[model samples]
Target: MSYRWLKWLILWIPTVVIGLWEYVRHAFLLPYVSMELGNWLAPVFVFLITLTLVRRLFAKLEAMQDSLKRQQVVKAAFEEREQLARELHDGISQSLFMLSVKLNKLDRAQSEADATKAMEGVRHTVRHVYEDVRQSISNLQNALQPADSTWLQSIHRLSSELEQAQGIAVTVDSKLYDGLLTNRQKVELLAILREALMNVQKHAGASAVTIQAEHHGALNVPVPAFSCVIEDDGKGATEEELQELGKYGIRMMRERAKAMGWKLNIGPSALGGIRIEITGGGASG
Candidate 1:
């Protein structure tokens, strides 16, 4: 039954039934029914009503809730598929088109110098396409996997990707506890971290990068505040340079943090490169 029907069943049914019973007992059966017998009959009436109606109604409600949860899961699956389709179209498809154009140019070159330049362009475009494809596959894999995967595992995966793609060294020092971030929080935090690392890969020109995360309050606390820092030992950005090359990624990260009501900071790192820090409260999902 619907919630309103259930509510009426729970509230008004019992009140109306008991009121009618009491009225009959007092007005019509008072000469035959003793007060003690009436008192005992009242509980018996309530018991019969509960056993015959309330129990079945509650079972139906539970079943309805379960069915709703299943539908939500199916809806979420469809949405994920749609998102993957868009990513393929926007990223991998465009990169493949560029790769095809470069191949055409390579094939039409007239001179040795022109051919060599075109070949180099083709190679660059091919590499770009490969990276885009790899990233899409990784994202799809992550989406299909279970939510129990920890932030450390995600960071390690990103580190592996950065190392493979950019030949950069990555070190991770995470002191934040697992099982303390909601799924939404994990997604947002990972997106911010991924963007920050991508900026380092594209602009830092550094050999090594470090990701450090730690809880902010007492270690023994059940739910503590936390912070994450991503930095590199590369040629650091002056404010002006950040405004030029790293602006898009930095702004995206800042927007994510703001959406989550967290704090995001960008500044020069002690490692002589850019530092991106995120701080927020931590609680179990």
Candidate 2:
């Protein structure tokens, strides 16, 4: 019940009880009303009023506590963003600048061997910058991973970051989101998608990638299953190559899916590259 209703009931209790008592005295129980009765009931009335005030006080305190928790979450997020900014400037920005200078030097080199050496330096710098970014993400996530973010919002952020970093076009279509999965499920799903995107950046030479996700019901199916597909238009893996030791990233992604009791499929997509599909059967928490 609402606090307001409780307050009203508490405030009226003494009057209601005393009036009923007086009515009973006149109608069936007692000979007549006594003026001293009001004095006797005064203590009970005071008690009810006191109890109402205490109830309101506790309710206000609880509301304030909730407000404080929300503010703390906001403050933590701000600090994490500030830390991320410092790392980006110190790491990624500097690396990209050096990579640009190396590319310029490669173009101006007269010897083919000199140009090849410069190109290798450029590739090494790029890899270092990517690793630096992923490490930064891990650090920041550990320190202040916001539980309130929706999966759709997380996907948008990830897709934008990959597009900017790899210069690959990314398209995302989602009809299922917030209510279809619990926070833990969303975290797992995002980890899987991020792994897939990393593979695309490192291996897929395609110009575009597409991600589709949904959670829908079917008459024959007892529960709606959460499902997502990531596909790219780059060279895909052969069935034999999929089992190679070098494909450890794919194995890790599969392990995550298996842990969640989800199916993980790796195969050719219509887009002409690889398609990764993950599906979970169960009701969302």
Candidate 3:
């Protein structure tokens, strides 16, 4: 069945044939035999058995290596999930609780107020706080969820949220096809994009941003690659600043691209802002 068993069979077949021939010769031609001939075959059979046992032991080692790889993947995913959960609970949950307290105080104050006008103001304030909390929770959940769609769709959703949160105009022109990237590539790209946008929110006083995707020729004939570019219209970073901050966000982008055998470009935009571009080709689904 297995290669090891086949090997043993091959080794023993010659010995079996020789034994059969010797028996036929003794019975018919020679009409004489010795037990010592039979005793010599026993050592060869024992050696073949030892070889088969060693092959089985190596097969077990290969199985253990496969198991270790699977365990490592599972552990990494679990750690990511836990980190997201802690962020949500510590940051957004605390903000919501504070808002709730303020709302409760306002409700009590309104009960003692002079009429319909006070009630309307209280209701409006409550509604705004509720909407803000809802949106904050939604964004946190979106960031934590596993990416299950096209790269284009994921970037589009991310841009839309940034537009709403920061009051900036965001646009996306993605042409990446669905199901063309491996799962690991998709996840790493998503993290890179998120980190880039976070840098924009923290440092760039940008009023507008745009993202685009294009296809290019691959190294080999008839193969194609995909590229994505994200640009912003904000005050561009100083060369020194770029060099410093690049160590974290931009470096991450580069490493992820390298791991996938892709290309990543990051620099100042022509419109006095920053741009990040990523490219990869011949990716299997």
Candidate with best lDDT: 1
CA lDDT, candidate 1, residue 257: 88
Q: Any residue pairs clashing in model 3, and if so which?
A: none
| Candidate 1 per-residue C-alpha lDDT over 1-285 given as tens digits, one digit per residue, 9 for 90 to 100 | 586787677767667778989999999999999999999999789888888887788788778789988997896687567556655665567778988888888889999999999989888877876776776677677666566678789889889989998899999999877766777677778878876876776668899999999877665554468899999999998888886774655666777788777888889999999888899875521
1-285: candidate 3 lDDT, tens digit per residue: 554655666567557766766667567755354557655655665566547754565566567667878996786677456535543453345446665665566556644654455556556555544544554465467656675777777887778777766777888777665556566667777766765775575467899888787666553433357777878888878768865643455555676678778878778897679988887775721
Who is ahead in lDDT, 1 or 2? Answer: 1
Candidate-wise lDDT, in order: 0.79, 0.74, 0.65
True-vs-predicted CA distance for residue 79, candidate 1, Å: 6.6
Residue range 210-251, candidate 2, lDDT tens digits: 999998565245445878999999988887766552255576
TM-score of each: 0.65, 0.54, 0.54
For every candidate structure, what is the RMSD over all alpha carbons to the true structure, in angstroms? Answer: 5.7, 9.5, 10.2
* Backbone clash numbers for all candidates listed: 0, 0, 0
Best by TM-score: 1
Task: Please give the distance, in angstroms, between residue 148's alpha carbon in candidate 3 and its true position after superposition.
Answer: 3.3
Q: Ten residues in a row with the worst lDDT in model 2?
A: 215-224
Give the poorly placed runs of model 3, Cα more than 4 Å off. Answer: 1-69, 72-75, 78-140, 218-224, 245-247, 282-285
> Model 3 — TM-score against the truth?
0.54
